[model samples]
Target: MARPLRFRRSPERWTASRVHDQLFTDLDDNLGATAVDPTFRPAGEWETRRFEMDNDDVALFIWDDDAAYWMGNTETPSALWRTDKYDWGEVPYQVARWAQRELLADLHEESPWLEPYPHVSWFFLPVFMSKDGRHTTREFFRDHAAGFPDAGRDEGLGFYEEFLSTGVLDEYRDEMSGKLGTSPQFDLVRMSSAMAEFTAAKLLTDAGYQVTPEIEVTTGHSLDFRAAKGNHQPLVEVTRPLPPTQRAADTAVAAVRETAETKTSGQLSEHGGGAVLFVDCSSFHDDQWRAVRGEQPEVRHRPAVVYRVRPNGHAEGYTKGAVPLDLDGAIEWV
Candidate 1:
């Protein structure tokens, strides 16, 4: 059995908030007073103003910057609040900015799923910020700032912080968990000494014929077949529960001989009859792979279309052959 897929949450960082505060102040000091403007300005003037100075406006600006930093210009729109309009204190503003910047930066570097936001990717901040002394001005940089240390390792941590602060993680976890709870189906191909007779029957089915487990043949052994279209030339035999008495010397050759015999017997003839040995080795070693070329076992004896299904809300064809593939090892079918 495979291990369950998990969303590994990690420890948080305490200094992240401090980092946000520092960036906001640095941005404000560099741009002077024009950072609070509701209107847009030239690139040069925008950089000098650091976005017009309203706290609400400052949050919006930093938020926009963060979005731009991570998503480039394609981020989804999120609700923006004008905390700067109230007396929420500089601490709140700094904390919010810090969290947003860190999350965006981390995500941009580490995740493949996230698309670049056309503008900025900040979750809490807005397109503007209001400060005590300066008039609202704009701020823009041609190149983005660098990301955090060991960003690969820190990204999960950063995202978790953002999740807690933004409340996205808790709100989304239940939904994600429900989806994970559902198990996916896959194709199974079993080849062993015991199922050899069964394999012969299955190959007949593959060629558009049907076979029942009770059919008797000339050899006095129960043959697994009822060939249709008058195509009967005994081509392959699938055996399960391979005979366990073999010594170590011929183990490899014995298996090869068994497999080769099935293939040779399964040769399509003018009469359209072939033989395939279906061996059932269910009682054999768990780690063994049933080695057969161009053959796949039915998952619970159902066709791939009937057994495998993709997740809901995903684009069709994203997963074709048994989505969330559950296989012991590579099964070659030529």
Candidate 2:
């Protein structure tokens, strides 16, 4: 006799009603529910319990299926995980697909997550905030007990001690003690350069200077900044069309002067500092090029692409006719 054909059945769903019913089924689950507010969950045994809040902001699990609506201060409905937006009525296939694709992209690139489906579990603890930003409240000491431990944890601590409190993880000293082992394998030099550029721009902003991105200036044309602190303004130009070997210093100077003349007109304060800054953003970092290629081999680094200055002299990466930039070399103000 031939074997009988077999059929597979769909999996059962963990419905919201089921989850809610299970919660009040009794206290020993330790997964007790509490509302976001202090009064929602009791200050004692219920301290660590997580719950959804009602309209009154009272932490209660009174489920109302008829309302069929989501409101502020309420726990997100369990059915939300099923919906497209994680709403009860919609399907979340698209969201699931996106999550999968993201995971795959990283994994295929030999990144950290190699598992097919990654699960993220969040433990929500109520955090209290005061208007002045210096107050905190917790429901129970036992629930927060893990956060505070013994002392003498770190052996050879370095600059990190400046950031975190010392020896707090002493109870878990065995797990905590150790060297960092190795530095990150990424290109630290290029990263440092990029960080420098960002820092420079930030410093300029802190200095209270009115800065502009990039602008093109013609020879003998001067650019003017409206709020030049020292009342001195200069035309700014970028060396897009200028080559290092054949760059004309006179032409560059003339272009800035012309920009200043056209924009500031006869208003230049002739009193203090007034000059142009011309920058070239063509520097090549071997690491960045290699990294990009490793990710996408088809896209070659275009080192020869040159930008041109228009007749209007509008561009980016210039301010007050000076390139006040940081280590990363991106021109900034200050």
Candidate 3:
């Protein structure tokens, strides 16, 4: 019996020569004579292989010292190229199949005669398989825990585990499917933000507050979460701070405030108070923190608090006006 392959971290050293050798070797075994006009060009650090479907060419490129591949025809190429860094230890044969599937799926949109493989969302790929070939949440959790031990105890991981185990995640998946039909790619950024909101909800629930997720307002803006205990009902907006590469400090801060105002405007009418929970993914400077802290008073939305939660789970900030809640003890700083 063949040993079950497990997901592992990428090796520290990945040279072009190693990738070239491994990729071609795997292709020889999987494709045989079916792979047409395959060629390797060392000068450009790329390789190309023609497939039977529409005689389309799929090319692999070395990007930032990582193996990345894209599939398309001679006239137009795929906008997005899938990378091998995400699943470094995955068999090259399987990688080829994935790229082929993606290419065929794209081509099928234009030419109905081109047969496409059964669609599989990128999020739930080969990662969810068990030793017995069964796919289960338990197996996914085990793989996740093994592959990413650092995030094993994270609140996001915990929330996902709970949701998967209790079937809430399936419902959420169905809701998303209803909103947006099936697609080949997954919006990882949006998913991460949702997970962050879920983490905040869990934290509030643990603190004895009844928490609600994704509350839509009459103003067409959505609050990430709402937590209520007794008469202290606070509308909470959870946001993952954008990296400096994506948005400048001034622009990011402005955007944050704008988002807060939209939510505050709607909730202030019904709720006792409002707060903004900024999940600090970006490495924020002292000036940025000061700017965020200073913005509280200017915010016309009174009785509002701003909390900046760090990657390590430590959080700090201030509350303005006469909010009945205590910021220090109410929130778990670490």
Candidate 4:
């Protein structure tokens, strides 16, 4: 069974008025009065200003024609422009989003820009805060700057600052949005096992084999991967050894052998080409691998080749029955 996906709500919510006030507050605090143009823009004309937020230089743009605000880092001037257009009324939300993304970046977190929603705050701040008693933006304001004129600015800055300092943003994102997180469509253990299989598929790709992961077969079981070159297309099943216990090793080997026999001897019977069982033995030692490999099981129909991959990415092939082709050379080819 897989874990249920969890949804989180942002601790601080921002409205248009909140964003407007915060931007101006940031402008006043960082760049002083000269940076902001007191003169109003003519209809259809736009104005831009450079300011600082938490010591980082930022750019603020106001489009009078559309009544929108665009703010981003001055260094990557166009980076924030790619975000969805924010009406002047939505400037606060836009700034809040930008601050969150920037803070995640500073923390070395992978924060992809998801579609923004109105009235709903999506920033997950607590996940990014340290377990230690480090002051988050929220905490700073609550503790030291409680009397600040603009509470929204402090809250927004605190959320982002805490995110940068804590560094759990990635984990939070994964748990909330990653494949194995909240989705009920996939089993967690199955997804993890598939990842290992995909690793083998990646190796096949690196070896110049055109490989596809998770190819469905008639037997209702999907082949882990399928690799092709010219007219040769071989079904590949990837297996990783179980725990070091003898019973676990025996069970894993039997499962692999049974799968190979059933698939190749049944739906794949008409095709002369055999299937490959790629075993990832990275977790195993020589003795463990030898025990896991065990005595070669008998195959009734098409020849099967068992390939063991080492931790350092080397592979050794073992053949069962009279395999006419050079399976080892074929695997290592290219």
Quantify all predictions' global Cα lDDT against the true fold: 0.27, 0.24, 0.41, 0.41
The true-versus-predicted C-alpha distance at residue 241 of model 1, in Å, is 6.9
Specify the poorest-scoring 10-residue window by lDDT in model 2: 121-130
Which segments of model 3 are wrong by more than 4 Å? 1-189, 215-223, 248-255, 258-300, 324-327, 330-334
Q: List the residue pairs that clash in candidate 3.
A: none
For each candidate in turn, the TM-score is: 0.21, 0.18, 0.39, 0.39
Positional deviation of residue 116's Cα in model 1 after best superposition, in angstroms: 43
How far does residue 227 in candidate 1 sit from its true spot (Å)? 3.0
Candidate 4 residue-wise lDDT, 121-143, digit = tens: 13333222222211232233233
C-alpha lDDT (0 to 100) for residue 70 of candidate 3: 30
Worst 10 residues of 3 by lDDT: 1-10
Error of 1 at 265 (Å): 13
Those runs of model 4 whose alpha carbons end farther than 4 Å from true positions after fitting are: 1-192, 218-221, 244-275, 292-294, 298-303, 321-334
* Model 3 lDDT per residue over 169-204, tens place: 232332222222122234333434434554455446
